[model samples]
Target: MKCKLVDVFTKQKMSGNGLTIFYDYDVLSQNKMLSLTQEMRQFESIFVSEVLSKSSVRAKIFTVEEELDFAGHPIIGLAGHLHEESGDVNPRTWQIVLNKKSVKVKTKKSGDYFYASMAQGKPEFISILSENDKHAVLRALNLTSENLADYPLEVISTGLPYLIVPIISGIEKARILLPNFEDLLANFGAKFVYIIDIGNFEGRTWDNLGAVEDIATGSAAGPTAAYLTKHQLASVNKPIIISQGRFLGRDSEIEAYVEAKDNVITNIWISGDVAKVANIDFV
Candidate 1:
């Protein structure tokens, strides 16, 4: 099997979140895909198969842990790779069908990078964390009430539900302090937690076990944008620039645009640049 490595959310190679994408991957089993994702040591990997047409394909995403219903960078990176393979200079849109839903991504070939934008659709405002749950989450994240911003720590989902923890400062000091952090979020209906620096629009998130910190989280960007717009911190219909991966030295920039009508968020779009890396062949 052959897989291609690409960096998402950055124009420069080796600067963004690295993703491994396997094309024509229907031959691989789910267990094998999971193993491959673990072997690659990437935050996530995407398998593309069942290409119905030039603009549509079936995709499955897997982390070192398990398969995901939907994700952000994987779809964007997969679309970028498809654009490169098309060898067309003009921009194109692709429909990537995942287990949960189908995502539409627009891809354009830039000078040295492929720019992809995904339509994450409407944001679902889930439940607000109660006072006690909030305290527990803050404890697990090693944060205190003082570190929080005036905004409410809420749960939001575009594809994956994330607990949006807004903080004014101390982003660098944040880390997962509990092994049951995932369980802690489960009680609040969150699959993961995104600790965001509202002052700087930067954010960070780690695996459930806190074993690894994600470089750039496109999955969380849509919710973060919605949270900002809902609180009137970000302008609706304007691009919100999110910064991430700086602490790990792989600086990445994600742009999110939120459209609202009558105080209701209608659409959320996440975009980033992708740089192609080397291809790997597995025996």
Candidate 2:
């Protein structure tokens, strides 16, 4: 099997989230894929199968624990890699079909760099966590109620579910001491919790399935931007820069563009630069 390791949401070689893309998707069974992801020990790995249509490809996303229906950084990284391998510097669009849905990803080459963007689906506002649940979440993070901002703690989804938490203070003041993620997820009905810095747009996400921390979460960025715009915190139809992965040293920058009309969000786009690391042949 051939694989490529790419860093997503950042152009720098050791920055952003590292993903391994397996080219021989059809040969691996579900259990084999899971074992490979666990063996790689990266945040996530992707298996790209044959093309589904003229420009659409089939792919599966998996973490060490389970397969994800949709994920952000992997899609972006894979798009850039595919374009690079095809030797096509021209701008092109491709659709990646996951278990739940298909997302359109666009890539364009400029000079030596490939810029990739994913068009996430319409934002889904699942629900708002209650005050009691919010307090419990804060406590789990070793934060108090005062650390929370005026905005509601919301469960939003572009593909996967995330609890968007708006912190009144900077991301520096935020800490992760999640003693029990299962309880929090059960209470909030979310797959993860995204703690956003209300001022700087920086975010930190902790998964319910015990992911220590995601270096750069491209999937969460779309819904986070939508949440800010819907509540008038961010300017609608404007580009918002989201910073993540700073604490763990692999800093990443994600660009989010959200369009809204009549107080309803219509579209969401998340983009980032990818850096190709190395290609490996594992038999």
- RMSD of every prediction: 0.9, 1.6
- CA lDDT for candidate 2: 0.85
lDDT by residue for model 1 over 136-187, one digit each (tens)? Answer: 8888888999999987889999999999999997898899999888888888
In model 1, the clashing pairs are: none
Instruction: Please give, for residues 131-213, the per-residue lDDT of candidate 2 as tens digits.
Output: 88888878777677777888898999999888899987756666566656766776666887789988888898756644467
- Which 10 consecutive residues of model 2 have the lowest summed lDDT? 170-179
